[model samples]
Target: MRHYDLVILGTGSGNMLLDEEFDHLRTAIVEPDRFGGTCLNRGCIPSKMFVITADAVEDARSAARLGVHAHVDPVEWKAVRDRIFNHIDPLHDSAVNYRREKGVDVYIDEGHFVAPKVLEVKGEQITADTFVVAVGSRPVVPGTPGLDSVNYHTSDTIMRIDELPASMVVIGGGFIAAEFSHVFSAFGTCVTILQRGPRLLTAEDEQVSARFTELAAQRNRVLLNATVTSVEPHGDGVSVTVACPDGTHVIEAASLLVCVGRRPNTDRLDAAAGGLELDEHGHIVTDSAYRTSVPGVWALGDAVNHFQLKHMANAESRLVRHNILHPEDVRTLTNRVTPHAVFTNPQIASVGLTEQEARRREMDYLVNVRNYAATAYGWALEDTTSFAKILASPADRTILGAHIIGPQAATLIQPLIQAMALGSTVDQVASGVLYIHPALTEVVEQALLAL
Candidate 1:
């Protein structure tokens, strides 16, 4: 058995946990896939880059509405694909080189836990004094009949396709679905979204979800409360049969993108063999300090968190690194200001509790909603379909949560996140700060004021 002082089972954010402080100790990083993991190779970065192009194309098409006679040339799929991956693929190589140069053992294969604190990688037994399982998650394709026989793409493979589809049928209504649907639809694909849930982005505030669904329907065909019965190969693409309350119908598309959800990669690691406690969904169960049920073993990121966001995983990486070094002085991970955003058309962002959550908890709160049309910037953009909503504790006026769906929604929600993180009240946020006149941030100011 090869032994080391530390072993990190995955390289997503696990790769970020390494530094000079751990140079003295022998360490090993086992990554079955790419060195930089999902976000760098597939998820956030690449998707956003593609989304930017789509957004630009969309703006050019709608430039007439703004009285700007601009035209966009046809997008060469190969150029865009090569441009993004050419930049991204090198970073992964560089990361691997850097880690190896630092005297860290890099195993480019799957690592499975066969015993406590021990993993089997490429027929070699690796044992470490301490282990951090940051294996993350993978795209989960629903178990629909004949799905395996059809050619389909997940978020991982969709962005890297050589050619854009003439039409796409997206399955799911979550962030992945919303973002990809926007990307393809704006890029001129006849996009159709089939969602089992009643609304897209069910995690957001109800009002925001409703508005987003309504707006999304305007751009593409959105079938809510619909479930897929089967997926099979059609002429050159695929056919999807969806069952709704009324009846069943077949939708054909040149491409199918499944964005239903993601499941923790714990199963890939065989964490149970290591005697680690896992939740019902197979995610490692950790305490506030990110310590697993077994001592000397830790897990973080999507392996333990419900928010499968890159920023959240990065935050946990910093905390886990510190806790690993100073086990005696372990600090609890705090997600009090956890915020996430969906990079779709009329982008959405949120921090803290939703209205449904607050009501479920039976908290006495006041809800305030301000449409983008109410702001001067909104008028400039001629945005008639976006808004921001704020929920606050009525007694102290402290903001409980904030949700936004509009241009620059992600950037606009940052100040509100700062307020909630620092315990700033609604009154403080609305009156204390200077919201630039006729700026998009005025929408935030108005929402807070309404609260």
Candidate 2:
């Protein structure tokens, strides 16, 4: 058995903790797979690169509406996949090499704690005075009958496929389904989305969900209120049986992308053995200061956070670092104003409460909506199907939430996020700020004013 000052259990956000302050301590980082973790290798970064290509292709397809008709070239799947991975793979290597050179012991093997503060990695027993569990999450493959016999892809594997499938059947109603559907459909592959929920992005405000569903349905076959029963092999492809409100039907496609959701990696960690607590969903239980049930044990990122976003993970990582270093003056995470965005066609960005959540909580709030078509920039893009939604407390006029769906929705919603984070009011955002004329942000200004 060997002991160390610290042992961080993941390379995702955990990789960020090796700052100058920690350089004096003996530390080890355990990463069983890729060095940079999910967001870099599979999730956000590379996926967005793919979405960028889809965006360009989509713009060309809609160019005729803007009186600039041009045909897009057929997508070369090999070239696209190579371009992203070729660049990202090297960066992962560089991260690992750089960390090792900094006097940090890097363990490229699966590891878990056998006892409190003790970890077992590749037949070696190691102990640390303090430990950080940042192991992330993995795609959950639902147990549908015969699913094992057929070929299917999760978010992890789908992007690396050698060639684009002729057509695809996306299973789920979340951001992954919407974004991938956009990518494949825009790349000229036929796409059909089978969602168990009544609508896509069910977590969003109801109106925004309806509008996204409306626009998405125009581009791909969307089957809502769908329950997938089984998956099986079908002549060089896969066949999916779905139980819809109408009736049970079989849909065949060259590939199946299961985007149902992700599950935390805590189960594999055997947390109970280490006297660590976990939630019902198998997420490691942690306090606001990122401390686990057991003293000297901390967890963050997808392994513990409700919001499994890279930015949130980074924030939590920094908080954990501060708390670990200054145990006497521990700092709790300030995550009340976290924002998220989905990179799909007519992209979606949101911060704060959804109207449903507010109503469910019985909070007194004022909500308002503004259509993109009403804005000057909307006329330039000829956009008709997008809008911005804002909710604010009437008493203080404090902006509680903001959601946008349209071009640059991710970038446009940032100002609203800033307002909420800075405790700004709806009127303040609309009147106090100077919004550029004929900009898409005018749509946001309009929404705030309506509030």
Candidate 3:
């Protein structure tokens, strides 16, 4: 059995946890796949790159409204795919090389616990005085009948398809489905989304979800209250048997992409053998200090956090690193109001509590919604469906929640996230800072001021 001071499992954000500060301790990293986790290899970075191209295509299509006709010729899927991965795929090799150069042992294989404080990687029994498990989540594959027989793709494999399909049937309503659907549809694929819920992005505020659903329906074939009963190989792709609100039917498309959800990787890690407590949903349980139930074993990122967002995972990683080093003085996650964004048509971004949560808590709150059409920049872009909604405490008018849907929603929500993180009141956020004239941010300013 080989032993070390620390053994970090799964790269992802855990790779970023290492710096010159830990030079004294003997460290090793075990990864089952590529060095970069989902974000670099599959999720955030590559998807956003695709979205930027999709956004450009969409802008060119919508240019006629601005009295400037534009056209995109010869949309090359292979070139776009190669360009994005050409830039991204090399970074995985660099991460491995960088760690090796730093005198850290890098094992490019999966590791699982065989005993307390011990993890076995590629048949090697390695024990560590301390363990940091940052193994991330994977795309959920539900047991829809005959699913395995056909060739299908998840977010992990869809981006690399040799050619853009004539049509695609997406089987989820979350951010992944929204983003990819926008990408392919903008590139001329007939996209259809199958959502089991009544509205897409059910996690968003109800009003925002309803508006997004309305907008998305206009762009693609969106089936709500849908359930996939079965799937089988038809022609080139798969035939999806869907039971939706309307009736039972079959959909034939050139591609099928499943993005139902994701679950933490604790089960695969055999965490029980290591005496780690996992929640009902298989997420590793951790205290405020980011320590697991086991004394010498710690976990962060998707292994512990239910947020399951790359940014959230990155934040947890920073705290876990500190807690591991400074055991006596560990920092808790201070930014409770973590913000998130969905990069799709009329992009969506949100921070803090939703209005439903406030109402459920029976708190006195005020709500204000300002549409993009009311802003000067909105008029310039001829935007009508985008808006920003703000919720605040009625008593002191402290900002409680903010949701935005429109171009640059992700960027506009940053100031609101900062305000909420700093516990700034509505008036302080609305009036304290000056919003530049004719900017899209004026929609946020208008919403907060109206609140």
Candidate 4:
């Protein structure tokens, strides 16, 4: 049997485990497909590349409102798509090469747990003192009737398309749905979002979700509370039958995109052989220290049921590394405020608790909101859409949540994230700091003052 001190399954953030600190310890990595995992190959990096181009196209179209009178030429899909892949594909290859050059044993195959501390990879048996499972997640396809017969694209396969469809019917209203909706819509496709819920962006604050729905409606049709019963392939298109409170409605489009959610890729790992427990969602159950039910086994990233963001995964990877190095000094991955940003037009970003969550908990919170139009920079840009909302606890004036919907909303929410992570009070953000005049961040400062 091949032996090593450490063996890490999956190479997403798990690759971070190969720090110089672990150079003394013999390590082996097993990866089935790409080296950089989903974030680099398919998820975050690629999606953002497409979204940024869409943003540029949208900006050019709206230049008339900004007094620029700019006309957007046709988007060369092939050229644009090829450029992104050209940049990313090489980086992916280099990542794999770097791991090997660093003297880490790299095994490119599917790895399955055969026993508590043993993993079988590509017909080879390997044992390690400690093992890390970070296999990540994949798109979950629901069991809808006729879905198999109809042609559809998922987050993983959508970007590799030869060309953009003329029109698309998007199923589900999650982050994947919203991001793609904006991408395709900005690219001149007639986009329609079919959400089964009452509103889109269910994970965000209710007010923010409602406002997002309104803004999205301006660009494309948003069908809310519509449950799809069946989908069938038409000639070069798809027919969707949805049952809603209004009644049954059928729609057709050139393509259908599924953005429902993702499922943990734990089934193939044979975790049961290692005596590790998984939740009902198939995510590995880990303690605050990222230790699995089985000794010598640790899990993080999407494979675990914690925050699924790339930054969060990297953070957990560091925590697991620390625990592995010094079992005596344990660290917990809790009490840290997690922030999420959605990349839609009039982008949405938020951290900490929602107003509704605070109210439900009865946490003595005060709410304050500032319209983006109220800012001087807002007038210079001729902006009349979106707002910033802040929620703070009354007793200590600590920022519980900060939500924004406007240009650079994702960038503007970072200060609040710093405050929440550092446990800074609202007064510190509002009075102690000096925001550049006529900047987008001033809007954040204004909201904090109101709180």
Q: What TM-score do all the candidates reach, one by one?
A: 0.98, 0.98, 0.98, 0.97
List model 1 lDDT by residue over 1-451, tens digit each. 9999999988999888999999999999999899878898889999999889888988888878789998877678789889889989988788889999999999999989998898999999989999998998999987899999999999989988888899999999999999999988887789999999999999889989999999999999999899999999999899999998779989999999999999999998999999999989999999888999999998989999888988888888999999989978999876558999999988999999899999999999998889999988898998888888889998988889989998899999999999998899999999997999989999989888777
lDDT by residue (tens digit), candidate 3, 108-219: 8888998889888889899999999999899999999999999999998999989989999999999899999999999999999999999999999988999999999999
Poorest 10 consecutive residues of model 1 by lDDT?
A: 327-336
Steric clashes per prediction: 0, 0, 0, 0
- Candidate 2 per-residue C-alpha lDDT over 18-95 given as tens digits, one digit per residue, 9 for 90 to 100: 888998999999999997789999899999999999999999989999899799889998999999999899987898
Worst lDDT window (10 residues) for model 3?
305-314
On lDDT, the stronger of 3 and 4 is 3
What is every candidate's alpha-carbon RMSD to the true fold? 1.2, 1.0, 1.0, 1.3
- Please give the lDDT score at residue 215 for candidate 3: 94
TM-score for candidate 3, residues paired by index: 0.98
CA shift of 217, model 3, Å? 0.9
> On a 0 to 1 TM-score scale, where does candidate 2 land against the true structure?
0.98
